[model samples]
Target chain A: MANNHAGLPSPTLGDLVLPKLYSLFGIANKDSLYGAVAEFEDGPQLVAAGAKVKEAGYTKLDALSPFPVHGIDDAIGVPRSILGFIVICIAFCGTFAAFLLMWYTGAYSGPQIPGCELVGLCSYPLVIGGKPLFHWVFGLPIMFELSILFAAFASVIGMFALNGLPRMHHPTFNYSGIHRATDDRFMLVVEASDPKFKAEETLELLRSLGAVHAELVEDK
Target chain B: MAGHHHDHAVDSYQLDPGKWSTGRNVLAFIALLSWALLGFGYFNDHERFFQSYLVAFCMGTFIILGATFFVYVQYLTGSAWSVPIRRILENIMVSIPIGALLFIPIAFAGVDDLYKWAKPEAISDALIQAKKAFLNVGGFRLRAGILFALWSIWAFAIWTSSTKQDKTKSIEQMKTSSRWAAPGLLVVCLTGCLAAFEWIMSLDPHWYSTIFGLYCMAGGCVAMWATVTLISLGFRSNGVLANTITVEHYHDLGKWMFALSVFWTYLAASQYLLIWYASIPEETIYYKERMHGSWAWVSVLLPIGRFVVPFALLVGRSAKRNLKVLRIAAIWILFMEFVDMYWMIMPNFHEYAHGFHLHWLDLAALGGVFSVYGLVFWSRFKSNSLVVEGDMRFEQGLHFHQV
Candidate 1:
């Protein structure tokens, strides 16, 4: 289901001339190159291509497949996620916040003396089962619960944030064979920002490496 | 994970029986020496001997039962990752009969000394007297007999079927285990919980927590994971199954140890929180006895040592992968399980009012029971292939990797 423009007529004068005029006037063009896209038949083929491109000094590489490719992270040099560290920090804050809330309402909000006309307090006081006004032994359950709750929320939100989710589009979508990435094929992209990017050479390299299809994608 | 070879063809699943002959003899000698010491304790300090024996008995018995439960779980879940190590656990599970044999001392001799409900003076207490039918010695013996019989039958059934599959190489054996696993799990859970109530909980006839059985099971399961890890590590160090049971398997075992430790804390907190909030005298009495005097240190140590230390130590992925860290943690967890059992059973002794005291017989009995049980386990373990080669997913287990 690739977008085949082969049957269409060749580009008119504006297609080739407007981009030069646009560049002369410092105006951006939709035809700006985003990346070179390659399609491979399977995960191993894509992983091999990833390793070769990385070895060739292409740092801005990405891959898309219907399933996770096990060694692709190492091949593509993806760093380990720091979401665990983020979640733990949030959990500690939650645990402290829970204890603070309990201490404020259970003990600090009220006067230490037996009787005092305390006013403008957020909470009066609470004493249950002859326990201390704010003993941690009694407060541990709530503290543990809040820590877990905050950690859960942080993981979900942190993962989405770290992944830059909720977006409508990505540069990889500009490839004509992109849709097949989610179905049968594996897609590898070498971004135009990479220092090693030479459109024709990269495309030739991917083709030589056994890509089923290779093409340069535009920003639009 | 580096510098380790994964040449599965080179790995030998056969354990040379003669290789462990020294270990067996040492264990047997220790068992003989400790049994003689325990015999002296039994004749001299009758009550203390039963108390110490019960603690050691529950320690070994619960772990064996937990192994049985674990084996059934692997079958029920159809877990391929545990296939290589399932035989080690099955060997432990099959030693339930030895555990039953060890209980003969407590069942026939120590019942009168151990259980207050078995004593005539317990009938004077209205609350305990009200439960005479189930709490009596006759009923306790009958229930103990049934519990042992059921556990032995199920353990042998699973072990025999799985071992027989080694030669048959049949998928029907897997189906058979999966079929029985459902009912087997139910039977083990019910009977195991009942055994916990009869053996340990009955030590305090007046005080009861519905969560005690689960607490016991959770501790035993953690100890079982630690035991399995230690045994696996032992085999590796002995140059047996060094390649077959790899770091991946050890990592999984470490995860079980950590998860079960947390689960144990959950059950322990559930039991404590309710009684603490309600302030019921009978329920609170159990904690009160342990939480005061010198016992308070142990009560505090239980959570810190068993839950907090292990949780922090093992929570990291790297720590579980590190063999040295995992080894220390397993041994620590095993020690904590014993401390937990000691905390549960020791406070019921008459000397408890005086404060915490570790009797010499406690060591003698522990060494005695564990050594004898170790011999039983070695025999069963050596009789079969160290790994389950017949398992349909054995290769999957061998190649198991966490992404």
Candidate 2:
């Protein structure tokens, strides 16, 4: 499907000349290059480019915009996040732990008081405020709070874990003009590792999709 | 981006009702058979008939009322994501009058059998006398009449104004509907509270929970979402609105169902925990009666079936987006909703019985009420666009995708 670049010529000798020269000189070899970075004026153009690349079956692609672009995830076919499920599971564990802890500390009495009857084996039941030993009502507030606490903890930690964030460096930073990605420009990166990525054809596709500036950035 | 060029013209998007005629006829036949069974139950076991009828009536009423609230809130929030399914909600609301009509049997014939306060002899008791002002048959019927009248008026106004905008395409109509919806919501909440108290909660006149109305409303919302999801899926499978109502919308609907199920559980637990902790006789009697026999199993099952199972299944994003998983969740929630209503109403009759008893009349009444309600909704839906094709935000909804 990537080869079906209609109304466009197949890559010729001129398209491969620059990479061949870079490899021969060893200044910035093809293997050391990151990918093609295309900068657009705004969100719409970036989303369009992302969609175009996705339709062309380019798997290793990323889009960065100053603000969140709606529908860009679908255009790029991003998988749904599993962070919510993880947080919920953590919250449930928190709730269970809180309930058990409350029961042990508040409900489970030590075998110190004489004539303290055990309801079950190892059960020294304490009647606090004339309530049952394991009253769920009294434990509800603690359960709720602990659930929220764990969910908040999981949300932050899980986000970091899933995103593989806190990175100090990336190959994309090797591009001199890529700093605009965090500012007013929307940038799309079609990685060289993608099966469909031919440096010349990918750059041509990006430019045809209205990228204001498209260029290849070296990895090192 | 490529599929964004879909025809925005309203005419091309209208659903063909002819394809649904055979299904509607089959439903009509089943509904007629159920009504016949109800007639048989009425003659054979008047008390059980009334009990079953109350459950069915309240279930149908709440779905319609809940759908009305759903539509009002959508308008109030100016939600774009729901525009594709707004017509389905409106069509559900259009069944309110039919539900009101179905209430006629319960109002006149089943009153004495259903309500303890309806018996004149009960007036001799001091507590019953104290509640006479609100619980008498005259007052009960009058309150029900006013509530249904308000619901019918709001349903008509909202439904007509929305469908009218299909042709007029006027922003004023949208504004008018929003203006009406704001106050209509309050009326719904108020009437819903009072009606729930009169119809279901008052069965055990000595017991009262302030959150009973909210509990019913939460369950109603869940049921409403289930109904909408079921119908939308059916339509999609039949190639109606196949393109317009995509998995994105189903995922949202699934989220609503999951959220409301959680809310319902919260309210149910709050009500139970507060009563259990207080240990007040009046309050605890409700639970005491429910916990007596087979009813105890139901009390336990309510949390598990209604909240825990649905919550566990639907908490995942993929579960909501998967068609088969969603269908199972939707159907499960709907059945749990019926069990909820049954648990509330049927136990009042079996207060002294040792175990749970399933009466054939329960199915008969549910079938009768739902089928009749379904028929009304089908006709109303056929008369309107399956999607809100003419709404200004319709295009936005068609292209909506969750980020």
Candidate 3:
């Protein structure tokens, strides 16, 4: 089984009889396909390899490494997204929330004052530096805090969303030799279904590009 | 720090011990003495720019002192990467005492010249009167003394340990700095903040902003980065650092320069927006002086020049990789930061219709500060290894390019 899988490029569409295989294997024509696994040593190397493979005209390829690699996105031709824009958006939300919450407390959520009948919401005058909601001096602190909280929280979410986590399945997991990715290993996987892929061609390409080894994986 | 390397230097990774001159003690004394006399003449000749001269001199001094405080902080944190560069900051901070000696006027002579509220007759205003306990000379000098003592100790720690390490090559000295780093930093920040309020911000007497300390801190950090940028460029241009300081190292430094510029702007804006939005007379008066007057051009240029100009120009590729371009951006940022400090400190006198304006003496005083700053730093470089070779992070910085 080990020798059978050794050094095979990610499969090309032409190498398989899709209709018969779909019937035999009971998969939909619109099914996802997993590819052969290649391993790497460190972040920069993985990022470099991912870039080269992408430049070789393959898409739908995925990379796994022991840690996140900088430029991995551009190396694999992914477009950049806005971490700052989202932070601004969240900040906007936070600022509004802080102001509104403060206003609500000042105008309606009246604190207990002895001999003051629970003043109706409308009866209470909103006063911060006598500016009302038109200008709330006291609320400026709240506004600043809100903006900071939102920006920080959004930054965390943005980072996590970009990384994509907690999934129980990945195609690379099927590559038994590739398990070292959890340790001091890095890997790039190209799908068999990519239009530019060919089993022998990709194997040759990866090996030529200085992969230590390459082997096919069956979809889980 | 990068320029200290030479290719014959490859064979000589060790510092050239000959550079530290015992013979030039007389010459060094002459240089410092001549500049001190020259600085006094320059200030005495231009009495009209008296307030400007004092504020500018004090600010320049505070910047060096504040930066020293920051370095002590990073040292106490056991920060490996910064150790290579901390000595330059220490050298600059040593100028603070020199500056403090220079600031004797604010201690006693400038009571009538600089402050309107300092007069006993002007104490009818209750708020100003209330702050009198703190605003008085005895109190002011007392606090000033305390601030100097705290900073001197922090600088003394690095200065003494570093020179000791130079002689003995003890790793434990590094560990000693690391252990006290955390607490020393806390004191530096605390004392540094009070110094800003008592020394600079409270010059207005009535106006107060809680964010003012942070405002000084952010500016201080940016100023320090600019000083480093200027030093790095000077070395590289002289062709002293052959393979030692490469484009990759510069790219890293430029990234930091870029990051600090933006952070300073963020802090400055945060403080400004808070004060502006509140619309309180006491708080808003701080901006009123600079925002509208002969200083108006500076007020306008500050936001546009300091932040927007650097942000747009540096947010590109060639600026960071090319040393000259990065230096230009750094120079511009430094220029804008100085302008911003001018905006903060100078406007109060003129804004109240006391009839003050910017003048050329400001430049001479600034020169005095820089001349002394440079002289100290150069002397320090002569004694210590220009780069910290024994630091554990030396290898990290070397491979900082490789990966």
Candidate 4:
């Protein structure tokens, strides 16, 4: 029988301990100060804090949780997503592209074939099975497929572009405990750049709204 | 209240039959009078009467079938959002038996006049001779009878089981209903397709499209959704189910109606496009007949009225959420549904004519068929609980909202 710990490292007290050096990354400077972070145990408390901060006229605030909290977007006064409109416009382009492709290849002339004497491309009005040169019905399937293809592409690209995702670093990551945002905890970050943000006042407000811990986090 | 096994307040949502007695009586009277007028017209001019009767019969049967489809879908999807208004659907479905009864007149007298393939002399043609096995009067009647029987049985089974669950509150009953719905839906689809074939498609026996069944089903679902929206609005206005079936539910129903309109358009457009592209003489004849006459205007208007206008009006989220907008859209859709049925059936009658013909019999037949169907629906609706109050999911449905 194989041992359970065959390929594993043994647990040690050193692995469980927090770093003791307070200034290991050097003293925080003006450029590296990110914002204040507030942690809440659940969604409602985070939403409550976000609403209060929004009401106090803080514009640069975001709420994060392991899952989406219904009504929180409106509570935080986030603008409606415009990704749908972008996808629709791109989908129309897709339809147009499909139409043009079908027309040039089948109905209209394209680049000349090497052995053919036709000036522009494949012979125009080359009838197949007595079908018309450019029947819309013949083009509809391509048009439909391309439209869906373009829309899906636009949806993914537009979502990432609008969200400013794939960012290697964010201000929220300055807080050591912020990794909990992807787990059990809810977090709200009030950016230092927001005009209404007052470090002391914002921290106090978060605490009053049931934040388990509030602290000013410095960016690296 | 939390520990209470049952809530008595739920009973308040049940319909008060006495409340709408006067209205019911009036509808009943109008129905009787319309039937009398139709009978007289049928005897006076049998040919014209049959033409118009086919249109009305198609509309009524499709409406009932649409309701049956909705009920099965709700069970199949395990949707709680429709629980509050499910009873209204059941009531609408109960009209199927009445629809079958209405078909008796057409079965006995109108078949020969309405169906071109019903004539033995016409079968001498190669196309008719080839199709004689399926298009013959005997086969048509048998298929129609089977379709109606299947529809009635499934509709009754679903409705009875649902109402029974309201009293028992048995999760097992819910399971059983879901079990029945799987097979029930298959039967509905099959019979619905055959019904469309026997009732409408065979009117122009030479023309055929495999997509016709889906096109009819889409139209039926749209019509049913519109009717449901209108009735729900009426109930809200009259202070019945006002709390249980809220604006949220209406919004959901409006979305369904909007989606079905698009579906109906897709199917109709696909069928037309395929036939036009092929340009085969057999298939092209259908559009040729429809396009050359004043029916051409109707042919153009079908897409605009049925698809374009409704799509534009209902595309906005606020339009679906607003009661007044939803009501207008619903009424518009219902009118378009009538136009759709009219377009399908009326062209066969005026194939040789250059212009549209408006006959008094058309109105009489519409009024006759709808009034009787409405009477049956109203009676069934009045006798049932306006809301399924005992449904375990009813409270959840009442609070359902779009996030």
Candidate 5:
């Protein structure tokens, strides 16, 4: 069984089922570089290095730290997220949907008979405690709750969507020392796709910015 | 204290007496004019005067309670961001003793005129009769006295401890204030609730909602943050503490104002929804009166003006950080708070219950009470540093930042 799983593994049903399985598996195009990564002593050093890298005209950079380092966003020139706008839009849609649901069930009353020739579908009008059949006052609670529900869902889903999440694997994981980022080390990765990235110059830049060690990351 | 050296855009925390006195004198003038109008309204219409005065009194009382709550919370949380703005809250909190004096007219003179439960004839009603023990004028006055004393003692204890820290710069002063904060918050919350019940809820003796106190406190909380935001903005424009309190602090203040306004709306909705759903006469009558005639306009405007408008205005990151937006939002929230107070109190009066009357006395009494409140706040302002200069977290607050 170990021999069967070892070496260049034999193709299985996944290869036939998922035509792009190799790319999606994050193991593809061997000899292609992902990025150059550097480790730093601490948060401040990482922040300073981020600024230096940005000054060196590298636009595509990411940092990993055990905790949030203040001023990192500004140093790296990160744009503000559009998650709030998305949430509000989704929340308004939720509000409208909630009102529509309540109105159809609690307020709308049309002839139920198929041949009645009415303009709208039949609904059982609920008049509890003598309240009007379709008052926003009564409908407000559900509308408010649904808006929150949708906004909350949007907040989580929108955050993930913006971050391009659900990614099974990441290039940075190829670096053996990456786990130290969760402990004491601070790491910065300059993507190979950056316009200014040249492997030798990038490695030199990282070493100049007080990196304890610098190396290349690979996709496979 | 030794490490408290840093250069900033603004040099001093001391108020320029000449400049601020001009503002105080303007408040004093407004007070005198409004009080004169109140006096005229009193002799002109006895009943209207009490109703309007009660509204103003409740607004001032709630704001003070809110300030007390805000100050104590900061102490308990050991919040570094609030240290720079804590003195403003402390001034507002310490000024709370004046609420006792403000409550005098309501207690001694306006009770029978304002509260249905206080009148001998009203006691004949079964509902009022049942509430007679808690709603009687004597018990009301006694409770008001004790509650005010409790709040004053708590406010002063924390205030003196904090102010002494301005001189002492010792961690012990911080400890003492924090020590008082835990119990002080409980007492304030409880007494504030009872005060709301006894003072405002008893206006409609036949109606009651268990969430009424929280509803009132929520509005006050919103008003308190708005008041703080306005004062801080005012100081910045006047070039005092211009650098000490930054946009980050305003952002936090704006967040508070935004959040509490939503909280106030939540409480309001909870109360209204339960009453509407149950459709019981006694509980529903409160909203019934509010939703009828011209009063209905205010009822509609109350939620939209208080919640929707402010929520939209302050929801964005840029809006909270923008001083112009914050100033507009603060003033609007303060206006809405008064509107809420008016909505709660004015609907109880039978004549005004049928029609929303923006009586001249309403404006006068509001101005009169607020100016007096401002004057007391101004007096405290003169005697202390504009910020908590000696706080252990003063440096942290001075350089506070938010992304």
Candidate 6:
């Protein structure tokens, strides 16, 4: 089952790195650190640094921060979060559910008492105090609640589902520096993912700047 | 940031990470004294419900405990909109024990005025008697204790970890806090419902509402935000919080206030419609009491005053983004929340009291509640870093909250 057919799938990070070079030699000692990995302190500073890094004909960079740093979306050259798209989709389903529930309960399903008026066992809106059923007066609260309830459920459910919540494992934990993620420290670690990644040049670029420390953390 | 340090006359800016301890101490002293006087007056004036004093006491306790736990939660999660003003929330939550302590006599008074379930003779309804498994005094107190304990444990988790993180700066602690929070919030909401049921809703033995729990929560969430925003404004206006809290932050807060205000209205309407449509003998009577017999005016006015008018004021973008508008809207909503609570709770107790009842005790109680909250919140704000300086979000907040 393990080794049935074709050569192993497209290279994971483990395949790309020379473990000995990363471990004993470190970033500066490497022949091509430019594409390997570059580290920065935190998000905003990284974002600021990243924009500059991005401008310097360097298309290969990534960043990690403790909290969301605004503009990082543009700076790091990552596309906008698909979370919102998921949110929109989830919100639609939630709203539909709410509408269906009420429609089913109120209009479709009858505890269906025999009424002075009936829309075929569906609950028809009564003209109470001259307020129209579809009007804002009657419709607003449910619509708003339905939208919000769905959105709320979708937001939490979407965030978890997208992020894979209740998740007990992550590759980032392999990096010791990442431990500072919950605290004051922010970091920008350029991955080997980018095509321009030449490990030596990347390390040179990072060291030339004000980086207090330069080291590689195994993404492998 | 380099060479930007200004030492001119020592422009006094120190992050009083928390204001709760001082606020709690002061509030405790005052609350104990005032509650004592009220307790004495309550004992002398009317023996109808010896436990009635506990109602006021619980309000104070719940406010303090409720508010602080809410604050701890918002911070623990790194909630940015609330980051600037959370210390006050911490203060409010901590002050609950003070209220609990003050309510000791009331708790001791048994079910006298607090609940009809305490007096078994008064509860003839076979159905209500069946619920005694849950609605009993022993069960009620245990739940209350568990609720308070959970809150205290939560508060302490924040207090200990936050203070510990001040020096240690453990990322694990922050993650630990975040991990604990979701469950903690669930527990709090659940306890909050049972607490409301035990402390407020059960005042009338026969009456019950399933949505009552959500109703109380929606009100609590909104009111907590309003009070915190108002206090944040006070701190900002006085140059206390300064750039740490700004209109952008207020904008976000206003959005939440507006969102939750709508939530309250939804819950309120759902509960009303469910009970009204069901038209059951017991359930309909709950609405019947308020929807008619002079209380009807309040029922009518609630939608307009509570939902419609404030909803209108909050809808526009300018109101959310501008501090002046946010403040006005907050104050309006705050007043309305007070009214809304009275509408929900007082109807059960006063029964016949319609419109608004202006009592000196009401004023005193309201003042004590606010003043104690203010004093406690500010003091709590002083004790800890008003912001989670260690938070991954702190730098973003600096940019966001910057004027």
Q: What tens-digit string does per-residue lDDT give for candidate 4 at B1-403?
A: 1221223233356567676686588787877787788889878988888888888878877987899888889988988899988888888887898877888878888888777788666757788888888877777777778887888887777778777877887787678778889998899888888788778888888888888987898898998998899988887787777767777788899889889998888888799878877789999988888887678998899999888888888877778889999889888888888888888887776443565677787778878888888888887666566776667787777667666
Better of 4 and 6 by TM-score: 4
The recovered share of true contacts, given per candidate in order, is: 0.08, 0.23, 0.00, 0.38, 0.23, 0.00
User: Highest lDDT among the candidates is held by which one?
Assistant: 5
Q: Mark the regions of model 2 whose C-alpha exceeds 4 Å error after superposition.
A: A1-35, A51-59, A74-79, A110-126, A164-179, A191-205, A216-220, B1-12, B350-352
For model 1, the stretches where C-alpha displacement exceeds 4 angstroms are: A1-33, A51-59, A110-121, A128-131, A194-205, B1-9
* Sort order, DockQ high to low: 5, 2, 4, 1, 3, 6
User: Where is model 1 chain B poorest over a 10-residue stretch in terms of lDDT?
Assistant: B1-10
For candidate 5 chain B, which ten residues in a row score worst on lDDT? Answer: B1-10
TM-score of each: 0.89, 0.86, 0.72, 0.87, 0.90, 0.62
In order, what DockQ does each candidate have? Answer: 0.13, 0.20, 0.07, 0.20, 0.21, 0.03
Residues forming the 10-long window of minimal summed lDDT in candidate 4 chain B? B1-10
Each model's lDDT comes to 0.86, 0.84, 0.67, 0.80, 0.87, 0.62
Q: Cα RMSD (Å) per model?
A: 8.2, 9.0, 9.2, 10.3, 6.3, 13.5
- lDDT sort, best first: 5, 1, 2, 4, 3, 6
Q: Write the per-residue lDDT of candidate 2 for residues A1-220, one digit (tens) a residue.
A: 1354586667777677865554344444444668999888978777777888899999888887778987778778787788988998999999998898788766776664443345423444667667877878878878988999999999999999898665455667766677787889988898888889999999999999998898998775
CAPRI band for model 1: incorrect
lDDT tens readout by residue for model 2, B1-403? 4524345333345657677686688789989899999999999988888888888889988988899999999999989899989999998987888776898898898898887787766867788889888878888888888888899899899889899888887787788889889999999998888878889999888788999998998899999999999998998788778778888899999999999998998899889878878888888888887887678988899999998899889988888999898899999998998889988877676443556677899899889999998998888765676766668898778888787
Across A1-220, the per-residue lDDT of candidate 6 in tens digits comes to: 2443586566556656655344433333333322333455655566676776677666656666667776766776875456656665666676566666455544453355566245454565455544333333344457656776777877888778775565444444455666776676656666666666556776676666545455665443
Output the better candidate (2/5) by TM-score: 5
What candidate 3 gets wrong by more than 4 Å, as runs, is: A1-35, A39-62, A68-168, A183-198, A201-213, A218-220, B1-49, B117-132, B166-170, B241-280, B313-325, B350-356, B401-403
Interface Cα RMSD, each model: 7.1, 3.4, 10.5, 8.2, 6.9, 6.6
Better of 2 and 3 by TM-score: 2
Candidates by TM-score, descending order: 5, 1, 4, 2, 3, 6
User: Which is the better candidate, 5 or 6, if ranked by lDDT?
Assistant: 5
